[model samples]
Target: MNQADIVIVGAGAAGLMAARELSKEGKKVLILEARGRIGGRIYPLPKEEWGYEAQGGAEFVHGEAPVSKALLKEAGATLTHPTEWWSVRDGPPSKIERLSPHDLQLEEALKKLTGDTTVAQFLDSNFPAGEHDDLRNFVQSWVEGYDAADIHKASALTLRDEMLDQGSWRQMCIREGYGLLLKYLQDACMQNGVEILLHKAVTAITVNQNGVSIQCSDGLIYQTKRVVVTVPLPVLQTLQFTPPLPKKTQAAAKIGFGGVIKIIIRFKTKWWTGPREQPFERLFFMLSKEPVPTWWTQHPEPHTTLTGWLPGPNAEHVKNHSDEEILTLALLSLSRIFNISIEQLREELATFKIVNWIKDPFARGAYSYSTPESKEAVQELHRPVDNKLYFAGEAICEEDANGTAEAALASGLRVAKEIRESF
Candidate 1:
């Protein structure tokens, strides 16, 4: 048996960060990642692969969290905010940019929320049926756009909590891709003597009073005093935990993992003329009706690539369709939104790509979201199971910060501290 002081399953932000923390105390740690690459959902594809810049997974840092801020500051990473938003609404599709008070409306609506209500309930009670439909759409769009959440299922408390907790409404993106953050963590792990084994998918974990034995699909075994399972929530649901904890199982069912489809389309030329008759001109984002309602450009950085986002129902809707069919849907959405002909779009389209996190066996879905029982479920995950099996991931984070890389990193540190104190 391959023995270690600790075994970390899934080398995403949480596992990698935990390895660094444990290594600081001279704990022998082994990190096994199912994917061939690191950085989990914060993928930054090389230009060689797509002939243009792209972030296949995580795109923005929503706020200035301490963990994220410290790492980013240390990396000498310059954080740049995207430009003003523009829309292509029904009236004439003019290029004139209009100042939108989207945040004000969203904030006012969020302030009225109370109790254990879902987003659907909040919207219905506040907006009614036909009146204030725009207000409803504004909040719903933010829910799907930021949370990648299912409106009917996710807690209203979650949305309210997130908005309340933010120190800044302005979102920041790394001038360099998000991969830089992962690289720093990866280097720290290596320097501290953590052993990282990529492409090692852990199939089963057997734990007893003495310790834990981990079985990998690669036909190897690892024995450790403690194990940190940081795999995605959906993937965790499918894992075989010997003498399973019923609470963990029920908790996993309570918290939700949402579906999302992201597409980065590289165009031959900058399509939006400029900031006027060209609403898309220098536009950071263009939000519209669903199937693919969200699109954003690599603005202020001279790039023609525009990312298309499909979350919640729209993402779930296209799960079984072929690549060609999915591509067509994206293309059609853009064609109608921009008022460009199909032939023109086809000609200008350089390359298109999709990240199938939903269908990926190891991921199973995008990130996690809050359910009514999310707080209790999350607290249960925080407790060490039999002093042998510990859990750390975005899913196990405090209800408010439950779906971010910062949360994952913080949780890793949290569990490592617990393990050390236990000894």
Candidate 2:
């Protein structure tokens, strides 16, 4: 039997951050992870004698969250800001670099969309209920692009409320691998006296007046006074609790994490000739009418290599297919616009990898969102019940929701504070 002051499941951003916070207060914290390595979704790819290749999750410190920025500085991680970054596909990639009033208007619209009502509802109501189909379609495209999901299937209310206020600067990528940052976090946790146990898949959690008992797949029992659950929402749903969660909690879990798939293609040399017909740092847009609508390119890392993105239903469709089939389809899709060939992909493309978070057991899905009928579901998911169990992750963050490393870290710290207040 293992015992600790607080037991954290999942060694990803939320879990690590929670553990770090608790440990800072001198609490004995232990983190159990199913995967052998840390950084649940945030990971680096294989080294083919090139530069930093990212397989799983890879993104830089985003947003103005003090916690995330402070952690980066605490770890001595240096960042390289790209001069030209993030271009949307709707138009010619609006280059209003200095955070203009137009961007703020869009921000207000986003806030109005996500906060009081669903994005779909907000768009519908904003345009006389029957007008502006073209405008609505454009707005939907932008929303889908953000989540890597289709607008119809995602939660409009959740999207409108929680994600709208996050500014444009919230999106950024790391120069090195995202996994490297995870390694730095691991080292920092160790220095802070936090214990991280890998290959520990928590199966069941029982909470009573005494405390919480976590049952693992390996038949190991961990007893602790408090537990912080940082696992993704989908995985949380699959887990069984002794007394069964409340109806609201169950409903919240059913909201489901948005499905996302990222296909990374590393080229021997830069093959893309910039989207704007001009040289820039980052390029993003809807490639075609295919399932994988959006694709983007970033400069080479250490070695000369280019990485592209394929998200949303396009990702779900290709998730189960073979590597060859996926590679073929992706190249074919890109070839349509780029005027490239499959032979070029076979020749110049050094390597390619696919990441489908929905298929991963550790992360059943990417993150959770608010649905049209269930804006309150997200709140239920994050609320800690009985003072014995707490939840933390990108999905549960109240303010800074959506797909950002900062959101995940903020969630961890939030839950840790909850535990501190409870005790």
Candidate 3:
């Protein structure tokens, strides 16, 4: 039997941020985390452990997010700019040597739309197929591949809003892995007096006039005054809320999320960059019409690793396949893209790994996306119940920053202020 002024449900970015903010204000905070490790969706893999390749459960800081920038600066993490390369599926694998007029067309299109609608709807309404197939492919691929979203259901308005807010944003990689920031946050929490219990799966949360009662799988009953739930929307749907949050539940159902299957392969040699024999030595990425549509190298790090990403509809097509089968398919896709034999790729392959978010119980999907019907879903999720139950996650972030690390951190900070004001 343990208690605190607040019991945070997850040790994710949002939870850690919330715990730090509240605890700094002299509130006793207890965080229950289902996983043994911290950092939730922001899973960071050590460069040494990952065959010297920089990887994260959710790294890829697409834009210069203020929260991430400040934290990374404080943590002494290095962010490197990645060189852009493009390729399209033609007879012998056509390479897009330079950026085209269609590069930032999505941003341009976003300015034209007046009302909230699905990306697919917006694209269809404005740029019909046949004449706009090139633009269609470019935008659809960017939205679905980058976001892991279903364009048909994903909110065009949210994408536009986020784009509008993005000023001179360039994609970069964190040299020291994303987990370092999490470690800094975790250390901050400890300094501020936050109690964290790892491997404590919260099964039920019952809130009454007295306070909030939390039941953990470890047979511990925690009684707290308030609870800030920072778990993924999918995982939150699994928890048993005593007085079921009808509005939150309804919002969760309406909000759209996408699935991703990221496979990282390591070769004995820097095959793609070295040896004039290889066709794509100068390029850092290869975008193809294969099963794994996106393949990128570990550049500026002197590693021979490539990450294959299967996003959006492509990931869904084979989401149920076994790990071994997925690995085989990745090889096949690469074999076709680089015009190499599968046997050769398998022979050169030193390691094959994947992070499957679709099957993860803690995170049923990769992240949230705005849908045609998700006009107020994020806002509904943000609304606290009785000022005792607070919700915060990337999904519930402001439209301009939703489904991002910045959003998660921002939500945590926002909710902590809300809790403080309520008290």
- Residue pairs in candidate 3 whose N, alpha carbon or C atoms collide under 3 angstroms: 43-57, 155-370
User: On residues 256-285, what C-alpha lDDT tens digit does candidate 1 reach at each position?
Assistant: 788888888888888655433554555787
List TM-scores for all candidates, in order. Answer: 0.92, 0.84, 0.92
Give me the candidate number with maximum lDDT: 3
* Weakest ten-residue segment in model 3 by summed lDDT: 94-103
Ranking by lDDT: 3, 1, 2
Local accuracy of candidate 2 as per-residue lDDT tens digits, 1-423: 246899999999888888877888778899999999888878677655445545556565555656666776666665655444433434443443532223444456665543454455566656534566655655565555556556655665545433554454455555555665677777767888899889999999999888999999999899999888877777877788888986635665545456676677777866665453645444333334444555655543434354445565556666788767766777776665555677876788877776767688888666555555344666776667777888887767766454567778888888988888877
To one decimal, what is the Cα RMSD in angstroms of model 1 from the true structure?
2.7
Residue 421 error, candidate 2, Å: 3.4
Question: What TM-score, to 2 decimals, does candidate 3 have?
Answer: 0.92
What local lDDT does model 3 show for residue 134? 80
RMSD of each candidate? 2.7, 3.9, 2.6
Runs with alpha carbons beyond 4 Å of true place in candidate 1: 50-53, 89-109, 130-132, 162-169, 274-276
Any residue pairs clashing in model 1, and if so which? Answer: 95-276, 95-277, 95-278
**Poorest lDDT segment (10 consecutive residues) of candidate 2:** 93-102
Instruction: In model 2, state the lDDT of residue 121.
Output: 57
Tens digit per residue, CA lDDT, model 3, 269-379: 876654544466556678887888889886767778888998887788888999899999899988877767888888898887788888878888788877866657877
